[model samples]
Target: MRRRLERHLPRALERLAHCIDQVRMWQPGQFNYLNSSQYCLYLYFLSNTIWREERGDEAVGAATRLFLLNKALNGIDLFYEIEMPEVFFIGHSVGIVLAKATYGNYLVLYQNCTVGKNHGVAPVLGDGVILYPNSAIIGRCRIGDNTTVSQGTGVINRDTPGDCMVFAGTAGALVLKPATHSLVADFFRV
Candidate 1:
């Protein structure tokens, strides 16, 4: 198990590096690092350290843990911290905050999205949930499986049903629709 985990470590590291590079390139003057590659390396180390601490043998699992921890400790607006099995986060960027919460597998968060806390309220996200850019889901809500929160949407004090599409605007009311694809496919489709 350990050897199998080690085999995938390099690929995990490469993904982290790529994420960091994209961030640096997107905001050249804003994000600063002593060395450009150090940020990714630090995340890579954190993932390994977290895995060893948790007694888990998989690097990808460890990386997810590290990512959640970093988001929590850094005062990111996330609300809950529940356990998950085999998670994947793509397109993480600066100002993206995840609440201390439990999310199911295949969660994708775009830039500037806030999965925030409202007092004791924390959201429970289901499998294959996609949060688009600038979307905000706050308070104690249950986001159903295969749900997509459109860009700039704010969902507060609501429970979304499974296989639904939700859209929010600055002034208009939030909208929910049926999803075209299955929840499992939303997670696996690149």
Candidate 2:
């Protein structure tokens, strides 16, 4: 694991730096290796890079180890094969499950949020989407840009329009209204 990390850490750090630099809370041009969120993303990047760059069973085994380490330390279930966006934010790494899906740029995910698949069909998300705590986007769905899946709202097998705030309606329904403000800007400078 140490050797694998040493070999892959450079690419991971570069990716992590690019990601955290866009966040408003993180100081520009600074990447804290000790920060848990940063470290979690680092591990993911390393695993993903290994999975993408290396070949043979050794690469798969190394990637699996890195993935497991991140899961054990951060409590996140982001697989190495999951194609996360180049620029995204994880508010809290704990209890976050990201399945294989088409992720958009500037995505935000809070604790206990999920982006899952339904019957092997994953949902596609647009740019600048936010998934609040305890929220989920499951099955064949197309989430529009600048949309917020509000806390505790579950969007199962449904599609949402662009530039809206989503809320849970009566009996597991989704209520989407045009967004008045920029929620993604609060976290990302972009």
Candidate 3:
């Protein structure tokens, strides 16, 4: 694993650098191998780089191994194929499951947050969307930019207006309100 990661380190580090740069709490040029969050991103970057570089079985095997390693160590289900933005933040990597959805830039996900599909249709999240702990966005929904899915809230098969807003409660009885402040700004530099 170390050899493979080393072989792919340059490209992976380039991608990880783009991601870590947007985070406010992280120092410039910081990539800690011992930090689980940073390592999780590194593994994802390596897996994705390998997958994008070739279609051979060896590539697939290596990517799958890296993905599994990330899942095993970080408890995150971010696949190599998921096109995560270059400037997103993972508050807590554990128990976060992201499906094949149209994620936007500056996406923020906390522990136990889920972005999944329903009937083969995925959600389309706009820029600066934040999924708080235990929140979910499922199926054919268009989550607007700077939208905050409050803790324990679930937006299933609905659309949110593209303004600074907060979503609370389940899909059937969602409560939408203008967000008081920019939650994304707190997590990211932009």
Per-candidate local distance difference test: 0.61, 0.91, 0.87
Model 1 C-alpha lDDT per residue in residues 10-82, reported as the tens digit of each score: 6545544443433323332232344423342344344644454444545446557656665554423332223
Off by over 4 Å in 1: 1-85, 169-172, 183-190
**On residues 69-136, what C-alpha lDDT tens digit does candidate 2 reach at each position?**
99999999999999999989988999999999999999999999999999999999999999999999
Enumerate clash totals for all models, in the order shown: 9, 0, 0
Winner on TM-score between 1 and 2 is 2
Which residue ranges in model 2 land beyond 4 Å of their true spot?
A: 1-3
Return the lDDT, model 1, position 26: 35
TM-score of each: 0.60, 0.96, 0.94
Backbone clashes in model 3, listed as residue pairs? none
User: What are the RMSD figures for all models against the true structure?
Assistant: 8.5, 1.2, 1.7
Report the C-alpha displacement of residue 46, candidate 2, in angstroms: 0.9
Q: Find the candidate with the highest lDDT and give its number.
A: 2
The candidate maximizing TM-score is: 2
What TM-score does model 1 achieve against the real structure?
Answer: 0.60
Q: Which ten residues in a row have the lowest lDDT in candidate 1?
A: 76-85
